[model samples]
Target: MQLLRSLLADRDWSQDAVLLSRLQQALLLLRDPAASLDEATWLLVADETAHYLDFRRLRTLEAQLRGCTQDEVRYTRADWQAARTAEAALASHLRHVRFSSYAPEPVPMFRIH
Candidate 1:
C-alpha cells in the first residue's frame, strides 16, 4: 500500500528493475525444493535487502501522508485495482528478464555411481 507507493515514487526505474529481478530469482528458488541451502540463504538475504529498501520508501510515504488530511489520503477501489495491476506487471516482467547465471530450465537430479 503506502510502502509500495513510496517505493514507486522514490526509486529510479533502474533500481526497481534490479530489485524486481532479484525478487524474481528468489521466487524461482523458493519454488524448487532441490535448490541448495546456500541458494535459499542468498535469496533470504536478497529479500531482506529489498525489505529494507521498501522500509525506507515507506518512511518517505509516511511523511507525505502526515502532511495530507484524512480525506486526501483516502483510497478507492480503483486505486487498489491499479496497485494490484502494477504489482502483477512488475512481477511478470521481472520473472521474464534473463540473468546471465540463471538457467532457463531446472537442472535434473542424477544418481552418482
Candidate 2:
C-alpha cells in the first residue's frame, strides 16, 4: 500500500505506462480470492481495490466537471465524500486484521462449580 501510494504521489509515475501496467497486474492478483495469500495480504488487497475503485469513480466525476451544473457539483462532491469514507473503512479493516494476526488467541478457563 505504501509503495503504491508513493508511486501514485509521483508525477512521473502517471507518465510511466510500464509502471501502470505492472500495477494493474498486481491489482489483479490482489483482487483474486484464489491467490492463496494470507489474511493480512488479502486485507491489504481489499483495501487497495477499494482505493482503486474510489479513484476511478472520482476521476470519472472530475472529467464531467467541465460543464457541470450546480446539482452536478453537489452530486460529484457527495460521491467523492463517499469514496473517502470507503477508503477510511478499508484502512480500518486492514489495520484490524493485521493487529489481530499478532494477538494471542484467547484460552478459555473453566473450573468445577
Candidate 3:
C-alpha cells in the first residue's frame, strides 16, 4: 500500500517495477494456464480486477508524466482522482480481508450452551 502511495506521489518507474516484482508470484498464479482456483479465491480475484485495471490505466498516466511531460495526453485532475479513489477502495478491501481472516465466526446461541 505504501508502495502504491509512493508510486502515485512520485510516479517513479522503479516503484512500478517494484510493485510488479512484489506481485510477480501472485500474477503468475493468476495467469496460470489450466489452473483452477476455488470459488472464494476467484471471488477475491474478481474483486481485485477492477482496481487492478484502474491502476493499470493510472500507471499509464503515471508513465506519461514520469520524468517528462506528454502534452498530447488528455489526463486531468478528475481522471487522477478517479484512479486514486479506486486505489483507496482496493486498499480498504485488502485491509478488511486481512483482518477479517483473523476474526472467528460467532457461535450460534443454541450451540453455545
Candidate 4:
C-alpha cells in the first residue's frame, strides 16, 4: 500500500485522526436500520482504506473476503467485530504515539519576514 507508506512517511497525525473518526462514524452508520446494505459495504471499504492508511492490517477476515464475488460483499458479524477491534486498537495507538510526541513541546510561532 502506497497510501499507507505515504501516510507513515509523512506522519500527518491530524489528517489521520480525522480520517479515523470518519471511519468510526461510518462503522456506526453501518449498524443502523436506515442504512442501505450498499452504504454499509462502502463504509466497510472506507474502514479498510483508513486502516491501510494507518499501516494496520485489517483485523477482520472480511477485508480478505472483500471483492471475492461480484454480487455479495457484506461482512459477517465476526468480521465486523474483528474490524472494530482493529480500528479501536490502531486508533488508540496512533493517538497515543502521535499526540505524546508533540505534548512536551510548544509549537513555534512564526513571524513572516
Candidate that would win on TM-score: 2
Residue by residue across 4-94, what tens digits does model 4's lDDT show? 3343333222244666565545555556779654665576556666745333333234445574541244433355456678788999999
- Candidate 2 overall Cα lDDT vs. reference? 0.58
How many backbone clashes does every candidate have? 0, 0, 0, 0
Ranking by TM-score: 2, 3, 1, 4
What digit string (tens of lDDT, one per residue) describes model 1 on residues 3-74?
334434433322446665655555556567897437655765455556546544444454486896423554
**Residue 27 in model 2: shift from native, Å?**
6.1
**Regarding lDDT, does 1 or 4 come out ahead?**
1
Q: Per-residue lDDT tens digits of candidate 3, residues 13-89?
A: 22245544544434455566776566755564454454544555775767676744433355544566677988889
Model 2 CA deviation exceeding 4 Å by range: 1-35, 67-113
lDDT of 3 at 30: 53
Give lDDT for model 3: 0.55
**For model 2, how many clashes?**
0
Worst window of 10 by summed lDDT in candidate 1 = 5-14
Estimated TM-score for each candidate: 0.29, 0.34, 0.31, 0.29
What lDDT is obtained when candidate 4 is compared to the true structure? 0.52
Worst lDDT run of 10 residues, candidate 3, spans 6-15
